[model samples]
Target: MTSPEGGGPGTPAPLAPLPPSAPLPASAASDLVLPRYGAGALSDVVPSALAALGVEGEHDLLGLPPSDRYVVMLVDGLGWHLLHRHAEDAPFLTGEGRIRRSLTVGAPSTTSTSLASLGTGLPPGRHGIVGYTMAIPGTDRLLNTLRWDTTVEPLVWQPHQTAFERGVQAGVAVTTVSRKAFRGSGITVAGLRGGEFVPADSAGQATAGTVEASRRGDRSLVYLYEGDLDWTGHRAGVNSPAWRHQLSALDHFAARLRSALPADVVLLVTGDHGMLDVAPDRRVDVDSAPQLRAGVRMVGGDPRLRYLYTHEGAAGDVVATWRERLGDGALVLGRDEAIATGWFGEVEDRVRPRIGDVVIAALDETAVECRRDFPMEPLMVGWHGSLTAEEMLVPLVVAD
Candidate 1:
């Protein structure tokens, strides 16, 4: 694996915390660091690329080269640090001599929320897909954004028109390539709708779909998605042999996608969020801890960052209890404090209640989880969604 622009693989450099341009209170900086929005953000990618290619939109943040044909491929959970650490397994990504830069995903650093940011060209606050699982506000039931709980309508929950819509309106032929099962799923309707939905089950199929769409017109924009790497990371920690095998496959996939592209086309590779392996001892079961469950009506989000909904007027008690119990392992913040940190990026009035009364962001390898509430969640080996560098920093690599 080598660095972009003709160099050998650089040593794996740990991501630094998000730096603040303006003064932040010592307390706030100690607990949270918000996503860097206007500049190097995942939400800035597609919009800026489109603008460079003559399809204008609300964003033009990252100055991607102008190209008539483009393929934006997102590898789920491929954090910048993870890729750098395992560069030997991903030669194509680290070897190619193009442009490379780091990008930050939206807060809560989960799949659905990051996808919404990518498609809508907005932050978590504006897109309103704040977490993996969040409340429907004024209701006790949790709305799993990934599953798209039937109780909530996707469009009503996320009313913004997507970047796909913008491409279509500008007469740029747009296509979305992903697993066939995701064709009409709730998350798709809310975030990835408006483009030609092409069902692609394998990497070859994804490449095939993109090529077919690209040849259909003189100018084209195809979105290619692959999730097997993320699936492997979840079942077998990112450092495990299974995950390394998946990483090797992704390196080949990157080469395959590029080999099949037209000479004029530009291929961009990126991801939703990064992953970190959590040891068994680091897993804290909140369901079994009375202090964690006390005064808490429901638990939302994932293991790394948990959203706590409390009983009527018990918000204060819940905050104090979680801080006391979790101590330095987690930072217990009120909803207002989290928002004030600008993590969600100008949370809309309608989106406020969806956030928990008290949010707990795990500070290290520790995971604040409730196993029984979401049975499948706790069984995973890799976890993300925190202010940690491994969870927030992703790569934006280009091949022309």
Candidate 2:
């Protein structure tokens, strides 16, 4: 395995020139427009895609053509900016004939929420995986979606049926190609339900599985995942050569798949979220920042964006303090304000508790790290889970 970018785990990236600051619009609540397909929220995109792929029902995101196979290669953490930056390494992607921009996952754009959203065709509000680790409503214990370690059963915790399941019920052959270990994992059960799981431990195996699915030439939906780029970026900054090498590997994999699949098959490549290099010097340890930690009960989500649950009656004070301290680097909003802003797309009744009493969205290239609690390795180097363009925006490249 390749070593990560920035120094060790918690070491932040060298600070780059800060981007222009843009606060989340005060009217964000009423103007909730789902990114990308713009049907509604992130949840609406997948179903729209399935519908376009000719899958019956309102839940299919890609509308597949009859007798045509559909392949969706979700490259974990391969942000649009990262792809454009490392175009040289991803020749097949950059040189592709047609590539379009896709919407970033919702606020605190982490893998868990985004993946759940894509898999279920529901927004974080519906799926209820809002952040990295969030408190289960009415319960003190936190729920870890990535690991699926929780008191609640994984299936019941996120009970929303997936687009894959709906497709299978509609007689569409559905398949998921990912690491062999994920075949029976809780995360897989919760997100990728109803799909025939194909174990692909290596890039070669992943490509082979995808090609084989496409060759079937029936109404098939093949979901493939490549996680190395995100892994490299998390360990090393996105600028690291190791990350670039991973991009090259993805490019080769794409080229190989394209060569193997029939021209009529449609292959859509996208990502869960983007990443930002947070330098060690810039890391604002929430534990150290009294103003940030004031009245906070728990800190969930990733470093770039965090969910701060304040003690009873301290919500207003906590929001004010965070806004004052983070200034233009982040947008601090009260719970009602966040929900009204429609940031999480129609905030469901059950999902309300998943959000923090005060939500913090990082704007510029800044991140809020918890030096005291989070594992040191994840705290360092490349961090994401924000609403910035770099982290929110992804690409939609199609190969026919």
Candidate 3:
């Protein structure tokens, strides 16, 4: 029972706990199980954003007062904690009223699930974008949805219509402002399809596009995204100066958009997911641990959160072994237990296969790494894809 590569083996040492001001857990909020926006929990938020743009829905959460314009600035990987930590860096965003809240971005907390949830206004269960990489069920090959390197046709694989499409159908002028290169990417096809695409190569360009989109009136919904913050956070630790620099840039971007948009426009800002800093020494490469790999088939997921698809009859043993090995650093649960606990939010029949037989959720920055395969220099430092408040709970900052 020697220590693992990055951190020592057995029970992992606890890092600084999340801030006391963090949002309460979903279970604490209500006794009745709420469908995740798409699977149905507090999904009204999507309609609320739509309502602000004049999209007629029985469930509108925006509650905008006759305003004909709306802008949803989705900062990639901008978690509430990260934002709160650098409030001064994000002066424009912090100066506004704080609507601090968190939303689950599905298991694995990768870009695919979070982006799909954001675009479709549905949980991963309904939308089917489950993880960073998933073996197309019944097949041995893994599909990378973000890069769209898969056998199935992108549209056919993920057929759910995006909220953007619904908004367009409801006569709201909908536009997606993002990196010019992603104008028609597979990820966009699966989740963010239906809206007019506005190509923007820089944060300033994106901010300008959002402002212009809102100014057009006649009920407009603009989706603006920034990717550098998440990129920096992943390669560099969340606390690193690089991450802070990105936050400062985000502040400037928010301010520019805030000043440029019409006063009547309701600007809502949120993120796909948060991040955690994984210690280089604590990383445990499953590739080298024979016992850990015993019954596991394909390992899919990012570092912080993992999905272990075990051999047909070995799930129980795998779970027991992992739980015994990792202790409190990771929570090992069976597929049924995970669903019963509402981690995936009312699992639909179609989504069940997408989940792993055994789910491993890292409770802290400590991640289950595959060292033999993954390098150290560029190893993931700020990792995510877990259920912790830092990874699962994102903010919903609104400005009038």
Candidate 4:
């Protein structure tokens, strides 16, 4: 190895140190278990806290010590790996809540799926809100589960009782403080229905309202959400100036919450997924790529992970074409393979059909995109919805 330029794959190449924005090399990296839903995951946070507060439920594998009150704050797209990369930007995070460990978000690592997991204390397989967009079975059209069509009832589609409902049933005071518009959204009705709805338009208001809610009862739970950080990342990539500015804003918000919350009240800050900035050239346009569309009936999920429903008897060709075309930068799998891999974490019988016959998951900076059908998505730079550590591993940064 020394004779060959004195270097090998294990040797550190002498070059300018790569910045956080630099894309990582493609190679099979170390592996981690599927998001441990019942053990350590976004899904476990509330239940763990509930167990800490003496609620009746599955024992907490996380062992949170103990706390009387909790304010669960979820910042959209705040992946654990992303936080470490830009830790300097968030002083409060790097200072008080900073730690080496992280918790996994549910599969696809998208908002709706993970939120359902968090709220219901179950994985995607059991709760059944599996992706950002899932096909309404027996229909050609894919239902944007977030926006959601009016015909479907949220409670009926996802019939599992949420943790909030359980908390309320146990006579625990539960309040949900979120965007004014989110009170009755499909996401709200399905997973976050039992808690008292408190609308807050600004971070200041949300934090302040949660503080008040904490003081109201001996046994209380308050859930808070911040979307601006995720919004900025989606619009201008996680590496963009806009996203950094938003990170600073999040730091200030975290500081405010830290200063205001009662000592007994613990704040658990987490995110649904992390994001990656996909270069324009790296984006594979399925609409324009004929091979990608050869046997595909429709496409769903998003840029990082694609759900390719196929025509009758075309799953084999489609999978081969996608893999051959996309090459090393992607993980192309059939329905059975995706489920068996536990990427979706125990796919349910009813929800199984919603998954694409062929799934294309970008392994590195590669993204599968569409310009013809979804015009806005193509323009966005930051993307998520995959199993990569950058997207699945999120912080459970705790503030006592």
Give one clash count per candidate, in the order shown: 2, 35, 16, 0
Candidate 3 off by > 4 Å? 1-44, 62-66, 100-104, 372-378
Q: Using lDDT as the measure, name the better of candidate 3 and candidate 4.
A: 4
Score candidate 2 by lDDT: 0.73
Quote the lDDT for 357 in model 3: 86
Worst 10 residues of 4 by lDDT: 12-21
Cα-based TM-score, every candidate: 0.91, 0.87, 0.86, 0.91
Q: Model 2, which residues run further than 4 Å from truth? A: 1-45, 59-67, 377-379
Give the least accurate 10-residue stretch of model 2, judged by summed lDDT.
Answer: 1-10
lDDT of 4 by residue, 196-303 (tens): 989999977898899998876778889888899888998888988889889998999898888888888878788989988888767767764344578888888877
Total backbone collisions, model 1: 2
* Candidates' RMSD to native: 10.4, 6.6, 5.4, 8.2
Model 2, residue 81: displacement in angstroms? 1.8
Candidate 4, residue 84: lDDT: 88
Error of 1 at 40 (Å): 1.0
Residue 146 miss distance in model 2 (angstroms): 0.6
How well does candidate 2 match the true structure, expressed as C-alpha RMSD?
6.6
lDDT of 1: 0.83
Model 3 residue 371 lDDT? 55
